[model samples]
Target: MLAVALRHLLLLCLCVPATPPLLAESAAPPAEPLSERQRDQIDAAASYALATTLFASSDLPAALHAFERAWRWDPGEDQLLDRIVPLAVSLGRADEAIRYALIRAGDGSVSPEMLRRLALFASESEQWDEAKRLYELWLQSTPESSNAFERAMVRIELGRLYRRQGNAAEASACLAKIQKKLLAAPNSKASRQIITGLGGSLSQVYEMFGKCHLEAGELHLAAEAFSQARDELETDAAANYWLALLELERSQPLDAYAHLQQYFAAPGDPLGAAPYELLRKVLVKINDREHWPAELSRLREQHPDSLYGLQAEAETLAAAGKADDAAPLLRRLIDDALSEAAPIDEDSFAACGVWLLRHYAATGEANRVIPLVSQLGKVHPSLDPYANVIKAAISDNAFAAQVNARLRLVADQPQTNPAELLPAAYLALTAGEIDLATSIAERSLADDKNVEGDDLLSFAVGLLLADQGEAGAGLIRRALEQGAVDEESPAAWYYLSAGLRGVDDTEAVNAARRAAELAPASPEFAANVARVLQAAGQTQAAADEFAAVLRRFESDPDPSTRATLRETRLSYSYLLLQDDRVDDAVEQLQQVLDEFPSDPGASNDLSYLWSDRGLHLQRALRLAETAVAAEPDNPAYLDSRGWGLFKLGRFDEARDNLAAAVNATDEADPEILNHLAYSHLALGDRGAALRDWRRALSLIDDAQQGLLRAEIEQRLQDLARQAGVGEAPEKNPH
Candidate 1:
């Protein structure tokens, strides 16, 4: 009878109940009144059954509570005690996990797995002493049945914990232990299986050693360690990637390239686009850009169905100006991925769709783009609003009726997401249907509960970008009145400042000042105040404010904060130059370059400045090249590079880059156009120069670009005199 009872107890502890315990109790009740111990046992069993059910149903918190209840009712069930800690730990119930784990530890028979879990939990919670003690205990208690790799992983965790606590000596001690274990680990198939199966790779062990050496500034030792990590498992992608990075840091591009190629070719899940980007960096460093096309073709041929291959092919097609060839491949890729029963490769599908959309948008093929937009929304529903905006923005007058019908479809649905209505409003605004646009905007904001401050601000910014500032300002005011965001928040005031800048200068300045007051330490808010002051014609005040903000962030410890400061200085310099403070602007830009020599934005701006002034033409060209390399598709960077080349008398190169810049920009900037015109004139294409200059002149705002407008006018007169034609013969810029 005793043996049967013990077996039954064990069975109940091991098995998770599928049927409700209440149902079982009702079916078979005790004949007589139960004793306290018997009642407790029955209650414990019931609670355990409930807990397991909750766990299976994915109600973790409720499961944890029920598990705790079971433990409280019957503490003698040790197997039952085992279930609580893991559940508690998973649910982030730190106190509960620790309490139960300590109870098991007190028994001096806790399993090594439980001890390791406790150690990791302690480490994550930042309980330095507790974590170290638990880790040390785990290392000591690791069963002889456990492999060396498992023991080494425990030591590595201890080493990482020590590093987190800034105890370098203790960390080194842990690393030494791991290294000894690694050296002794057998190179047999069983040993490798144990290591890999247990999720502890020999490569990972060496990688940790490399990291320790690297952190200690022992570069040579770090390199050797990383090399050993790569050699330990020739197929290890992580080891190759780390070694490649180290080689790059050591200025060994050729070595990095070999390792990167091995990493790229390693069998694994597709590495996506990052490896290709890194490969490009190495190729650029070696000045072997001519090999790029061949390398891309080889990669594509080797892995035709992989993301890496597809990305390489896309870049190849784009570079060769073969969008027509790329279009079918991209469409097929997206179609195949979507039609598959397996999980889709979302990033690859989206990239293909974006490429197709961009090609259509550029070519003004609204009919083609609209269908693609619909297809994209199936895979990425979050992009629906954005896709709609793109559809509307690219559509011509011929597509206006189609766009209006889509808007009407959305408008008829009373409970549709308000975000869906914004594209229609934008479309109407662009189509010059002001009344319809206003009505759509009203409908978008009809449900205040559905709209938030971010939505309002985003739509306002969009409208502002589309040159409907009055409508944008109205939305901003409505958001403020509705208290969509906290009135006291700096962000609200900042939004107000931006929304009202051109509409109401005084209000904008006041709102900017309020934001600055609320967030005195925020460089962005402070910078905005300066910009607002400048826009309001308080030039001296703005300059003083800029100086103050610059001084404040000059000694900031955080690298990101300092980067923001550099951006602020860049903005200040641009504003100063606009106000004709040439010497001040130059000083500010020079200071920014001195502080951040390799910053792409600063490099591009300063390079453009120098080229415009015909100063340091060669140096400007170098800086411009750096910016272009960093962001190849950036129109502004391309314009800067073109201007630099033009200043250096490289007319052919300048013309190519300027033409690329013109193609890249969605709506052409007058300054970029003027630069392109300069390149044309330098190349002796007088007719082309006149045409571009006229286009630039038409785009320039007399209110904001008085100097540029005057320069274009003077250039037109000069060209007229040269051609012996009356006022340079007006031609339609379109």
Candidate 2:
């Protein structure tokens, strides 16, 4: 066994084989006196033997020193330098190795091996300039005795290195040489031997060629090269992955799926970084649902805690209306993450907690969010997770105690990162904790003399939405002037549009359009583009964008994609509804509900519209009930149900639900207040109706004032007359 292992280990040496031993001196006839040169050669042979012994013993540093001594003693034994340089480099003495390599090349030595080895070292270490220089020298100094196939391989590697440094013109030059040479001798013995030596590296060369073209945006050429590589090497998983990516880009999902299946079936890749999420999505897009469950189960079994596995399982379960099953899996994942021995970076573990909080928030299961917050609070070093939980609580209508506990969890935590403070401020604003939001925002901006572009943008957006619009805009302008904001960044422009939108500025439209243009692949960005266009009265343009948004999502139907699809449809339909395009809006809304039957927001919106327009009270009641069932604690859904009852003339039950909805949160929503006022009017509590409408009007912003002010003021006057309060109504008690 030792002999067999050593036989294989001999290949690791640069030379093909060791020198043979000489005949025994005692068996030889009497010899003449040695010449000076012969004496030096005999001494060199002794040094070489000692060096070989040291090398066999694995004392590489001593072996290299002895090998250098042998080379010095016998200037004729050039092979000793061959052993010395690579050994030196392997021992982390690269500069010294290169010095000896330069000495050999400058002397126009018989061997180019040292120069070639130096080039390999430089290339492997990513010192592209030195690698390029050394490769050129190696090619120039290569002895005529070197094999043609080995030289061609070096040229191929040099081309690959050039491409890696983004010098595509030079890379193409080298590839063109190889192509030209191949054209001349398509099936030569040299080529056959090179292929035998390369094993799978030939496929890697072609794949890199494809990547060079792909990076240059020459998609057709890239696809051609990748297909050629896949054909040449049937089990080349990298080539298959590239081809799948290119096919998906071309909107050929079935072809992409086929190629991806081939990729995952290949050997030696069960543990490699397969594009599992993209494969899952492509399987979904092409309706290959039958194969997905088994594939995903295999993935989870193999990579249980991987980002792809965890997210894929959780997303699939949630999508199938099995969020209850998904929740415990996410909880266990978080628990396992938190149980890790103090890792150097706990961000990934903390991120797991955020995903659980996100799922609960999205499903309107706010109370489920509290326990994860407790888990994260104990494990996380930063306050970001607590802030995220607060946002979840605000969304899910969680108990005030739960929300307050998370709020306090982050309140005393020291925020060293402005990025951290921004989320906290956003949570405060969303939870109606206005003073805290303002305080954090102001503090963030005041301390923003030096911070990342993301931190500045995040803090600015928080301030803008928290009613410090002018101050926020000022910070944004400074960031723009200082070049901290990239004009082409979709996220930066998106935030810019958010800041400008409150003042109804035309630039907001341009900013939104830019974001849409930069992120044509993002459904959320496209939806934003459509929304701003619709708001700016470019209805036709907005309609086109909304249509584009739908087209973008058809090929990428993850949970977020599905959610955005619903939102895009809703935004477009709301515009149609405003224009009195009732039939068109109804068709789109019906389609949205048909596709996303479990969506609470969709149920509530359509139900509220029916009740508001007096179009279908009975059906609206059913829709409202569905929304309430989906999110029992949601105040908006409760208001919808209460108004549906008011439309059906069930005034007492309407007042009861309206009162419950209004009292659900400390900061009463103006929309719910308006609904409650109408319920009071229907109950003939004229004084109560007048007071509720007045309270709602005071809380209403300019955006809502335009739509509801006239109706609310009219209701107050009629209620005043009914109560006989006459011209005054007890100072419009708020």
Which 10 residues in a row give candidate 1 its minimum summed lDDT? 725-734
lDDT (0-100) at residue 441 of candidate 2? 45
Which candidate number maximizes TM-score?
1
Indicate the residue-level lDDT of 43 in model 1: 63
Candidate 2 residue 228 C-alpha distance from true site, Å: 51
Clashes in each model (backbone N, CA, C under 3 Å)? Answer: 0, 0
Computed on alpha carbons, the lDDT of every model, listed in order, comes to: 0.71, 0.68
Model 2: per-residue Cα lDDT over 1-734, one tens digit each: 22222343343344432443364344445557655455445556666777899999998766876677566546556666678767776776664476466546555552477677778877776778767877778778876457888777777788788887888767766665554555366478776665666673556656777777666666676786787788777878889888887888778998998888787666444323346767977887888777777888986776555543665677678778897887777677666656762131355556556667666666656455545544664554223555646554565445544554555554545554444454555555557676665555444544445345665676677666667665566667666666666556788777777677656558878888888899978878878888877777788888878878876665453446656877888887877777788778865676566444445777788888888777567667778898899888889999989988887788899889888889887888887888888777666576687688889888888774667777678766665574675543332212
Cα lDDT tens digits for candidate 1, 524-643: 898889988888888778888888898886655344565677777887887788788888887677656544445688789878888888765666787888789999999999999998
Model 2 clashing residue pairs (backbone): none
How much is the lDDT of residue 13 in candidate 1?
75
TM-scores, one per candidate: 0.40, 0.36
Give the poorly placed runs of model 1, Cα more than 4 Å off.
Answer: 1-487, 535-540, 666-701, 704-734
